[model samples]
Target: MGERLVADLIVERLQAWGVQRIFGYSGDGINTVLGALRRSGTPRFVQARHEENAAFMAVGHAKYTGEVGVVLSTQGPGAVHLLNGLYDAKLDSVPVVAIIGQQSRTVLGSAYMQEVDLLNLTRDVASSFRQQVNSPEQLPLVLDRAFKAALADRAPAVVIIPHDIQQAPAPELEQEHGVLTTAPVWSPPTLVPAPADLERAAALINDGGKVALLVGQGARGARGQVRELAEKIGAGITTSLMGKPYVDESHPLAAGVMGHLGTSASGFVLGECDTLVIIGSNDPWTEFYPPPGAARAVQIDIDAAAIGNRYPVEAAVTGDAAATLEALLPLLEPRPESAWRTSVEEAVQRWHRLAAERAATPARPVNPELAVRELSDRLPSNAQVAVDVGSIVYWYARQLRLPEGVPAHLSSTLASMGCSIPYGLAAKLADPARPVVALTGDGAMQMAGLSELITVSRLWPRWTDPRFVVLVLHNNELAEVTWEQREMEGDPRFDQSQALPDFSFARYAELLGLQGILVDDPAKIGAAWNAALDADRPVLIEVLADPDVPLLPPFPAGEEKGGTMMDALRKEGRDTQHARDLLETYLRQEEGLNRGL
Candidate 1:
């Protein structure tokens, strides 16, 4: 501590940027930065069980808090382990900064241990900003730029600091020609489309009879504007998975999430609409959209490129969702409640009834739909939700009714398994007073959740409200993949790849000194949820769910996929009769709904 080192400078710069914590794991390569963090003792350091999970926690931090999440790791294998989570941030457009430690510069070409060309390895994921610090004088410049680029692009950025550079003496920038000083500073711009563009969009909306709005995560801040516009124009509102939390699903006109794992109401709205308004969303499921020329379209987005990316937009308003809607609202004339509006509401009501019926359907041990839907009413108003990828997401999207203002996030675009626990940890750490509930499937539990539970056990004692509840769908099947193979490839379930080894998730939580509740009886699902939500410590609720429940997409698309699933199941012979029966039951129900729609 004689004089501040470059590592100390790095810590000071992070504090200046308002970073309160760094998610990472320890290794010899990064010992210097670890020492600096220990000595300075400003930003807390969170150590995960592995480097991969550490990276996931950082991405989760960014997603939950809307801040530039910082993660540190030693180079080589540790850096390699970070790729998946870094890609999750890149795909979801979350801002994260990964600082990696490299081998000493003196051993540049000597093939030293734990030496990775991290700059090259991370180039794709951190294409927005990827830099390596070569000198102590370069640390500040690189660090500031990484944060700025991450904010500007809303993407992950990478900074690789060699061990020698990290331990080098901190340099002072002065009135020197070659030296530069930088501060951690950046802010979002107030962006709105031109008046003429807004007027054009308004005209299109006013002209259309059966209008539908497709909202995405970009419209998060414009919820009020979206509701007002929907009211003024008498339009139905549907959200992409990423936009689910932003729009109140409880709204009468709310059609729920749209796309493969979407609701029947959404399918009807998108299928039958004559006019579509794409608002701050470039949802990738183009097939679910209205057929080409089936609708007149208007698009609004901050990024000009995304305006026309999904659908054919006759009017493009390149601006922020809230601001653009404000300008466009005044030019619109309110449409009186009509048959189209009535139809939309009817569809939404029908979906609600259908969801409840589906949830109550009996299964082998428990119905996942029923298990997750139980949380709808039981969830606290101040709770935050994290859902892992798999069949569980379909249940979350279709059955769960999140309270207004409650935020639920998942690795949607990346569709990565094992993200829920990390995301839940980040959300809980951000606001310990609020309850956190994570919904994950058994496959994901084994992939990453098991190890992360240790992290949860270690941290729960420090939480003000120890109400972190994790609901695991313990079906002993890779249910999503099993269905995907049948639907996509028309292949029978290859038990080797589609089945999972069993593990006692609830008992494991008990071993870790946390509360554990196992529910196999469908009748006990609600009681289990109540106990876990009100528990004094972190709780893991393991539900013995049935894997036979179909992962069918919304109808029309579901029709073809259902046919493929039937063929595959038929090929499985009489041994798979139960699954075949379940599929047929769902298909019949969907066909009836389709006829009504």
Candidate 2:
């Protein structure tokens, strides 16, 4: 008999890659591999409630670890469930490996139970796809190629292991002893801006009365160069949400973010600048649409697909953001003394002051924005933040101040919900010593894989301390705020029928053996947050908030639903019958509480 079964060979390959853990849910088809893993005892198993959650957890792991996070699922629905997370990983440039099980080799085309064409289903999402491993002889090469494709492309890879093959006897193959390396090679591409292109960009900057730099996610690795360029040209900086951390917000040149949720400073700067130079950013909905229209735009990006995709550009320099910025810096002459820079700086200052006032106001029910700021204040200077999508995203992005060297993770392009928990887990797994927190909305958390909380409890017990805090801003309604916003726009019949039944997230956390705190009073928030962090365990703080409040600093003036709020207030006069009725409900509740006290 051959020394290795097909399953053992697969485990041997995985162990060589230095993979410490594989997040997965086992099924009959993949049980052979599980047994092999048990025997190897090198790469441990972290079981998840659902395969989707497994894939999501892997995404989180890769974000912090920068290693190839591994996920396993059975055939059919299991593999199907893994698709969303895989797509997320692909979009976010997180490296992951998904080991999926298929039906017996004999019944591959015969429609066996839990049998489906996973290869085709996952082709679009995964960076690399492979299947049909009949003998142990092919395992080493197939595995090697899959890892290369995944790490090199910085995307997800899927490997399908057929059931019959898993149990098959080994072939006469040489035992490879070396480790399987899967680290990405970040060599600078050969596409530098031409000398003429650099001169043109420099001339545009030097000649313009006022210039604004629009940075995006592609500027992530080029933060230093971005700051240097901004300083050299005395340029104002505004960023898309994905590019939030490109320039430190505290920097003198930082003008805040742009879009519907944009700050007043970014809008003001965009309106005043004669030239808008975009670097590594391509957010269509936010960056391009509400244009000042007259400003000349120049874009520099490594990906040719991004140029001319969102906003029209007079000059599109195809090169890396940092390198291009360096190339252009020397071509430009220093700006003569100009009031444009001073004027933009004043606008930014005014915006900052206004934001500070809003943050300082101690609302009775603790403003969500204030809550996020308080969280930022309490977190360690180097903590990693993973945020889920919703109204709260705007709140945190606007308020949370990331310290230098701290990396923040968010799914900006896809804007997927239910990502915070998994992302937080991945961050923690990648660096167990660093503090990792997931700021999530109440509705978003329900959609996330709650069972992964148990996985965190089991594997990284140290995180049980306040180190892992999942903050749930409990507004007690789904889609209600948007419906209310629409109702304000002259649609009295705007319905909030999508609101979910309120569930006790505090109880849910306790059930998972993690600390759970329900926060209703504004005064208790600080103490509760402090206690949670000090305890050093996994904690979930469910904040009860009034659902009627609008997500503030209203939408831009001419946006589609911009006038809806004002229209609703006008039609139903401030003291109209409906308003009186709602006020009566509030009065009754207030009186009831007073009497009880």
Question: What global local distance difference test value does model 2 have?
Answer: 0.72
lDDT tens readout by residue for model 1, 463-572: 99999999999999999999999999999888989789989999999999999999989999989988998789999999999999999998878887988999999887
* Candidate with the greatest TM-score versus the true structure: 1
Clashing pairs in 2: 60-426, 61-426, 464-536, 464-537, 464-538, 465-536, 465-537, 466-536, 466-537, 489-564
lDDT of 1 at 125: 96
| Clash numbers, per candidate | 0, 10
In terms of lDDT, model 1 sits at 0.91
Residue 350 in model 2: lDDT: 66
